[model samples]
Target: MTWGRARCALLAIPIRPNIRGRAVMAYDDNNRGLLLALKYGDKMEGVSTMARWMARAGRDILTDTHIIVPVPLHRWRLLSRRYNQSAVLANRLAELTGRLAIPDLMVRVRAT
Candidate 1:
């Protein structure tokens, strides 16, 4: 999405503390498979590549970033999945950018 569209989309969502957001790539047919694999197929071999893309895409934000926190998964989902794709990406990004990855900083009080 264009910056204007992205901004408007973000504005519509209720996020705590209101932070800027970026998309590494559009979730189109070209990237849907890779994304789905990482998110649901337990295929993490592409995480490093994806994180690199994220670091590049969010370079501006990373310059001022102090910590990388991945959104937590619900307890049941975590149990079934055996891992959080977001945390994996966060940790990989931290390794590439020298940022701190605090995977447990956020807790999911309830399932959405």
Candidate 2:
């Protein structure tokens, strides 16, 4: 996956659960579920759903690649948000695919 000033992209390799040359890499808010629980508070069902999709879309890539690279957020953004949403999704994806999710491969280059 790659991220630029305003864009984030994922490289999808064709394999099972997909027959087309291209596939979706990221999840938009449109395709998510909201689960409200008294004990667990608000939960994003989208996480698991997206994870399954990621695992299916990248099944072939996972077998060939050694690591999963998730785009990093700026420290300021991370602090404000308290989490790197991409990293969370990436972790779920790696877990679903049974692959090692490596978040340190790419560093967030601060704008200088």
Candidate 3:
């Protein structure tokens, strides 16, 4: 899952040396619609299903994962949407995978 590959599902970030690794589930057209609906339609239940799939995709890395941190959304976007999709997924992943999830590791400085 090295970054050298054109499209690796797992992101092996060099800067974050403490964390073991990061992985992504399928990102094809099938998932795109479901993700978009979960992000914009306030479909909270999707979090569970997504986490299950994410957990399956990332099961191997879970053992080494101490915590899960999702990419942040802009403040304005968060305010309007009332939630961050990534955070939702992370939290659910935390619950299902027994790993801690930190929703906000950093700030965007300003709205987009």
TM-score per candidate, in order? 0.82, 0.60, 0.72
lDDT of each: 0.87, 0.59, 0.77
Could you give candidate 2's per-residue lDDT for residues 23-56 as a string of tens digits? 5543346433232121133344577786787677
Return the TM-score for candidate 2, rounded to 2 decimals.
0.60
Positional deviation of 50 in candidate 2, in angstroms?
Answer: 0.2
Q: Say which candidate scores most in lDDT.
A: 1
Question: Best to worst by lDDT, what's the order?
Answer: 1, 3, 2
For residues 1-112, could you state the per-residue lDDT of candidate 1 as single tens digits? 2344443233585333435668999999999999999999999889999999999999999998878989999999999889999999999999999999989877797887
Question: Is 1 or 3 the stronger prediction by TM-score?
Answer: 1
Lowest summed lDDT across 10 adjacent residues in model 1 is found at 1-10
| Runs off by more than 4 Å, candidate 2 | 1-22, 25-43
Tens digits of per-residue lDDT, candidate 3, 2-63, equal 43443412564344334454445577887787778888998887778878878888888887
Off by over 4 Å in 3: 1-26, 110-112
Order of the predicted models by TM-score, top scorer first: 1, 3, 2
**Would you list the clashing residue pairs of candidate 3?**
none
